[model samples]
Target: MTKNCFLKESKSFFTLIAVFFSCCLFAQQDDLQSETENEFWRNVQFGGGIGLGFGSGYTDISLAPSAIYNFNKYVAFGVGAQYKYLKQKDYYASHLYGGSLIGLLNPINQIQLSAELEQLRVNVNLDGSNSNSQDYWNTGLFIGAGYRSGNATIGARYNVLNDKNNIYGSAFMPFFRMYF
Candidate 1:
């Protein structure tokens, strides 16, 4: 065959393949959008937690808001935002802001298994003769279980990377959650 004819046929073959794949991609995307629009509202839940503490020379406060999508009776995926303020007189004060990815499983009635990963920015200020401040990112992973009653869940989690200097504080933390 002539060189020009061979090149023309090759170009046509490549163009056909490209068009086929593009159509397939768009078809898959449309199916996904249709499913998402079907019962999206029924699977959505919104709620979170609030924490407060007081002491002679220290105070702690936190607010966390979360939303979840239940995939089935046994599985859920969620996201949340966290904000915390800590102050210690004559010592230091800090602000924590972060977000988290959460997962849950219900193996039986009233029982839930939970896990979460959080990434936070911690800003610290020291009060002293020579004051200093700094900012950094902290990440934490927690795993635990909870008891669910109606719209409330009470649980205790252990942070795998918890340390005194970690913005999340203790290794063992109790949590309260509500869903609407």
Candidate 2:
């Protein structure tokens, strides 16, 4: 329910994952004919989202990189890490870092449906205090649908577990997913 969650330590862990995935992304070669066809690697995809917004001394920045394994044309499962920082000049500052499990289904090439469960460690300091003023775990389970194309999906999801200090700020959030 509540505990000391170190932002520094988790930052290191996420950094390591980011490096490993970056390598995988760069290792991809365009000429498949010249290389061995590894079915496992072929069905894997790497991509994520970055968000930044600032206005009138308020700032929000987020990074979420994920990898998914597609079992076939119809099913997929994956994990992702998320980190978001929110700051309002003289109000409060928050750090949210954690991981999620996601499952995807495509009944047809044009439609995608998904279910995602996220567990996050939240830390907030009020009035710019350097100490951790609040620490807690927040959970969200989102069910969504989107329009799917070659490598992208645009959709909105509703968090069934939406509660106090909701992670995405709303019960409904829009998402853009791309895998390459």
Candidate 3:
């Protein structure tokens, strides 16, 4: 009779342990599912923007092409190039070529943080000279928040650059972005 009791109790203890372990496994699976639901991927992006120049007295239009790779759900890095045209009244039209690095702080959700660094080259025709031109190169940094839904994204950035040629000071730039 004692042997029977001992065997029964041992079986019950093992059954309890098995139940506990199974519950833990289920919880871990749920956590993994949540994580997979929130991941971003690397892909191509194309966007355009319009902004007012702080000192150049013009409205600028920019075309940007970017490629991004997400390390996880919350972080990504990208590189891209931009072409900008600025029309200033009574001054030479300026063309800008820039390369940029972008960082996405939250790559998975609708709301995210973004930061960018750009190296820009500006070219303008010289006044009263038929064959003369002026060029300038500068660096810019921008930071802001963004919202992404499906393939569409919208964001606003504050830009800071060295205005050595008195071209542009600190300014606010709002942009629209699309990815595929």
Candidate 4:
């Protein structure tokens, strides 16, 4: 085989191996935490975000729902889904849907660290006689730190892959979380 072909194949092989090992590591760590005193459901939290807005010039709607499992005091994992729609008067409309894999760590009572991997699909259409439509996918990896108080957390995160054309809009974003 050509040298270029061999190199390409090796990269793909290494990526698959890395992903496999990561999955195995997370699974083993979670299993090791099963001995905690709390019941399975007791360690689970459910919450998300909601938004609805309308004006003379625009409309907006959003919904996000998530569930998290606190495997132990230091590690947690979760998943979430999101949907949003926006429209501007006599201009365009957009629809977006996505899901995320979340990981969190709390080393103390007041500080938390988080990571999220998200995959989203977005569709947009212009209005008027010469209208056009486009659909695309966006993936983002965000890392953040936050202050925690009781059941609420507030933080800022930066998306490592954010770009001017990405659905996330900004490389920097703020977040609020609550555990029930």
Candidate 5:
């Protein structure tokens, strides 16, 4: 009977150890899952920026607001809109309204490369003419690089567009963006 008692005691002790270890492992897994969820939601971000460019016969200033949703650490997609005002050397000022699609190479950490395509409506007033009511559509392609830390991003882009007069040129824009 002594042998039977000893065997029962050893089995109970092993069972208790197994349950304790299993509970610890489960708790660790739960903590890891919660952390991962937090990081995923943190990848969703929003930002805005302003920039200027100077070219022959015109100087341009623009504002853009953007938002992004990151499904993971390495990929993100976003949409944004921009408003641009252009002042020509001897012509009436023009206004442009546009939107873009933004893609990122790496979204959750520091460095990223981006590409964007945008379409705009350009409205211009003819000099000294009552026919200040001309409107046209333009399309732009922009390629850029960026870096992000905390809530701020700084980037530069090369933008090309076809205007109403079939004028095509490249503009450089420096921007600051914030994420919330």
Candidate 6:
């Protein structure tokens, strides 16, 4: 074949291959998008909170971490772990560890409602001359409402099942929830 003809054929061949691969890539884009849209892990979020307080011979520390799966625009379900350490000078020391299951609902863009069931194993050691340790479990069922912003909510929840064994002196707890 003539040199010019050979070059022309090669260019045509390369151009055709390029176009074929380009079309293949573009076609796969839709399939990838569709698959990821329904991916379970992709729709899951991680969030939680940490707290610390100190006052004259008194100390409090807490950590709670959680994960949730977004069912849709308005609903999510999650699990969480909690740890708390409290010490009061010449008073007592306590350790609280637990887990929780949480359900969340968003009826509007700015409102979030939640239900949480938590069970904590509490161990306390009384300070001073006659000191002793007590251990037990505390269970709480909380219902709460909050003002919601993107990926976060601030609210308070009230425990409906508060009894003598409950460690938190009150049945009300303030919360800040977030997800990433």
The candidate that wins on TM-score is 6
Candidate 5 weakest lDDT stretch, 10 residues: 161-170
Estimate, for each residue in 85-113, the C-alpha lDDT of model 3 and write its tens digit. 87666666788888999887874589878
User: Model 2: what TM-score?
Assistant: 0.76
lDDT of each: 0.90, 0.90, 0.74, 0.90, 0.79, 0.93
What local lDDT score does residue 18 receive in model 6, on the 0 to 100 scale? 100
Query: Residue by residue across 1-180, what tens digits does model 4's lDDT show?
Result: 999999999999999999999999999888768755358888999888998999999999999899999989889899999999999989889999999999989999799999999998998888873447888998999999999998889999999998888876689999998878
**Index of the highest-lDDT prediction:** 6
Shift in Å, residue 44, candidate 4 = 0.9
Clash pairs (backbone) in predicted model 4: none
The pairs that clash in candidate 3 are none
Superposed on all Cα atoms, model 5 deviates from the true structure by an RMSD in Å of 8.0
| lDDT for predicted candidate 2 compared with the true structure | 0.90
Q: Which is better, 1 or 2, measured by TM-score?
A: 2
Encode model 1's per-residue lDDT on 74-129: one tens digit a residue. 89999999999999999999999999999989898699889999999998989873
> Which residue window of length 10 is worst by lDDT in model 3?
39-48
- Stretches of candidate 3 off by over 4 Å are 1-61, 87-90, 130-132, 162-170
Over the stretch 1-180, how does candidate 2's per-residue lDDT look in tens digits? 223366766778899999998887667653353354576788899988999999999999999999999999999999999999999898989899999999999999999999999999999899956774889899999999999999999999999999777756699999899999
- Candidate 2 error regions (>4 Å): 1-37, 128-132
User: Quick one: ranking by TM-score, best first?
Assistant: 6, 2, 4, 1, 3, 5
Superposed model 1: Cα runs more than 4 Å off: 1-38, 129-131
Whole-model lDDT, model 1: 0.90
User: Residue 69 in model 2: shift from native, Å?
Assistant: 0.2
Native-to-model Cα distance after best TM-score fit, residue 51 in candidate 3, in Å: 10
Instruction: Give the Å shift of residue 88 in candidate 1.
Output: 1.1
